[model samples]
Target chain A: MTFPMGLAGPISGLVCGVLFGYVLQRGGLGNGCRLTAQLRLQDWTVFNVMFTAILVSAGGLYVLELAGVMHAADIFIPTTFLWATLLGGVLIGVGMAIGGYCPGTSVVGAAAGRIDGIVFFAGLIIGVVAFAGIYTPITPLLGAAAGPQAQTLGDLLGLPAWAVLAILTGVAAGVWWFTRRSAASPAITCAD
Target chain B: MMKQRPIWNSHAAGAVLGLVLLLTFVLTGHGLGASGAPTAIAAAAANVVAPAATQANDYLGWMVEGGRNPLNSWITWEVIGVALGALAAAWWSGHLRVRLEGPPRANNSGRLALALAGGILSGFGARVSAGCTSGLGLSGSATLATAGFVFLIGFFGAGVLTGLLTRRMWK
Candidate 1:
């Protein structure tokens, strides 16, 4: 209810994190090959899982916001820094391809006793420290273009949030449909 | 020594994860995150070791000002939970194993080195962009934040390109 802090926060977070991690491992995302299969265009499982989650949560949040049950404004919607988003995304993407796991997956993999995951996590700590050490020089660029405005996909596209969500969901569904059909065809081996 | 069943159906798992994200927002008014917790921890540690230097640093200073134990963070707990849950699932599924993942051609040392480099880059990127894949890509996108969309585009776009470049790794 009220934001988690102190004992309650850590307990709740631990429970949630465990569930989240369990789901990730169960989804085969803990496996590097299954995740990188997306890059090979040989598997659509990653895309399917990602967009499906997006669609469900997007729709769910919209409904919650509309019902006034959840104050969407309370959530920390990050400000848009065009350059940071683009640069950060590219860096993370490259890392995922090379490392075979993103931050979350790396954690899950580590729990499953994957040596690579542990190493990656150690790197993550080092990276954070490195960023801190260089914060003065990079502060401007890192925080650049971060206006306090709460813009969304709808605002950027000049459409209603629900409408955009609907359109996006439809597109995602179409992709899923096509991927399913292709995967089912005898010729394709559908990697994991 | 035995074949493993395919992990839960992707669609089903995605739906569950989506609902979890939605619940997180509904209950706490925040999305799931993984990187910030560690950063905060690092900041707190820095503060203890070198209070003046930590205070002087722009990033660590912001974290220290937030007024709470660095470890007492929502993301921190969620991450801990993630590890527990993952272990449980692995145990149940009989897929739990201690091993390094890499192309059969790669050695353990090489794989470990790459993992470290990748982690560093990913962590820095998450901080710069303000969130990691889950926090920014999933949570942010669900919220329809503009930054989220930009991040999604940048991450996936670069992913495809990089994947192409490293085609041999997977093959």
Candidate 2:
């Protein structure tokens, strides 16, 4: 039997967004402090959740594709633009630290009744407007880094997808183990 | 009399999120996103306010092509669902409160201004990168996309550096 059995696209997106949003809100990840804490090396919760989610989904998707249960090519893989991605990411990250919310968490934070989230969202709108105004000038840099290549980790590393997945999963497991052990200490626990 | 947890356990919450992502892929041949919703809305607004200018801009033009309503996109509706879901979660956990959050030293006005500035930066960045954390970093990385991984690194690295530099903002 097919999984996700006959659900329409919009309905599926709705259900998925709801579930994803709920998890983010409930996990205290909707808070900017908790997320930033990961960077401070104080709290491992964010790292734990993020890596785990990535590993699980990555592994799951691979397995499903291998089993012929899912068509991997149908997935919406974003194109690569080395310069644009790096520049945009750095800016977004800095904004997250300053504002205490990324685009996604900011949305959730606003929903959770944080006034700051609303303000942050307003800034996001303005930022988009500014970008649009200057789009002509930046278009070349933004869209011209490299080939809009659809390469994967395996392709870059010259390894099989499964191999890369296994390595990533191992790394995640190691981080989890270390973080858990460190968290058990009274001092470290307080830091978190 | 009782201390309430912030929300749910991270692992449990993450597992649910993973399952949802998996389900999304299975059904829609795609994944969840957040920032694109607003971009589309903003594009539509530009189209209405300044159709000529919107048409002149390559990015906005792409969004307005086919005479499709930007608000009619999947990302827009899903973002609505996100707000609703977060509200539900917050309400259930009794964490729904209205207040400005900032470092004790910063005034509400300043905090609000900074928040707005940060949001603007993030929104622009999302547009430049073609996705935010969820769409690019999470979804893209999950699929092992090279651009996604690069974005992830840049995003997190810049975040840490900025967070440390602006530690006073949240203190």
Candidate 3:
């Protein structure tokens, strides 16, 4: 069910975006040291934060979906671009490792007055332009694998969505334990 | 207030973010996103320079589907709020200032160059995959999409690999 794009859309987006940004910054995602540590595998702050968010959203979405308040079908779901999505994920990960700013974090970083974040955002725009320019040539390769691939794990396994989400919650708990055990003695700081 | 206040616990922040995602979905029927706004801007720019080409191009044509103004999108408004919200948080926490983030051995130019390169790759990847962390990780994963899990795996793998390779950038 496609909703009409109107004032409410942008207004709600603004409210959510603001809250997202505030939490991200207050959560230390906007901290260069913490972000770098996350990539370095020394500090698991990012891991903890990101996975927890995923779990929360997953659980929330499932509840909403089941309650008939908002169905998953109504959300903006991504089509399974098998190769493109995976490859893009790798590239994004590598880029984050290199630049130390995730997509949303880059905006927060810039807002927090990090010059590097600003520069990275500029590069991101340029990259988008380039992608658009060469989109036609790459469409065939990226859009390959025309078989069924975008189904959810729950669908494929014939399990309820809530069950799959419960497993994820367990996984998150495991990660928390692991991160707790892996905490560095001094809590790694940014070195100049 | 030019001092650092201890941050909220990471898990706590994550939960908050998740609540926000739920709120957004409740209000708009979609999850949060960060890169789509940039994509919209790029498409809008292309439309201005070459109206026909933008409409004809498969990648950019969606921006104008149903005669929609890509610039007037939720992602744009959300991203704008992201910046403002971050600024507000920073100010409240007394962490709002410019301090170069390169290691002692690395200079400003080197760090900036890396930022540019990394940003470009990330942007391009987001476009290619059709979602960023917010779009793919939070929203897609929340929806339990297989592509979302695949993207998450690939993302972590590359991050670990590049982190090993680019240790000098931060440490």
Number of the predicted model whose lDDT against the real structure is largest: 3
Per-residue error for B41 in candidate 1, Å, reads 3.5
Clashing pairs in 2: A123-B119, A123-B120, A124-B119, A124-B120
DockQ of 3: 0.64
Please list the residue runs of candidate 3 whose C-alpha ends up more than 4 Å from where it truly belongs after superposition: A1-8, A146-150, A184-187, A190-192, B47-56, B61-68
lDDT of 1 by residue, A3-38 (tens): 322233676677667767877888777777666667
Second chain only: TM-score per model?
Answer: 0.90, 0.92, 0.89
Cα deviation at A123, candidate 2, in Å, is 1.2
- Per-model RMSD to reference: 3.1, 2.9, 2.9
Give the least accurate 10-residue stretch of model 1 chain A, judged by summed lDDT: A183-192
Please write out the lDDT profile of model 1 over residues B122-141, one tens digit for every residue. Answer: 88888888788888888888
Backbone collision tally, model 1: 6
Q: Candidate 2 residues A1-192, lDDT tens each?
A: 544354544666577778887888887777765766665555677767777787778888988888887766677777788888888898888788777788888888888778988888878878888888988788889977674467888888899989998898888788888788543334322111
Give candidate 2 misplaced runs (Cα > 4 Å).
A1-9, A181-192, B1-5
Q: Which whole-number lDDT from 0 to 100 does residue B11 have in model 1?
A: 90
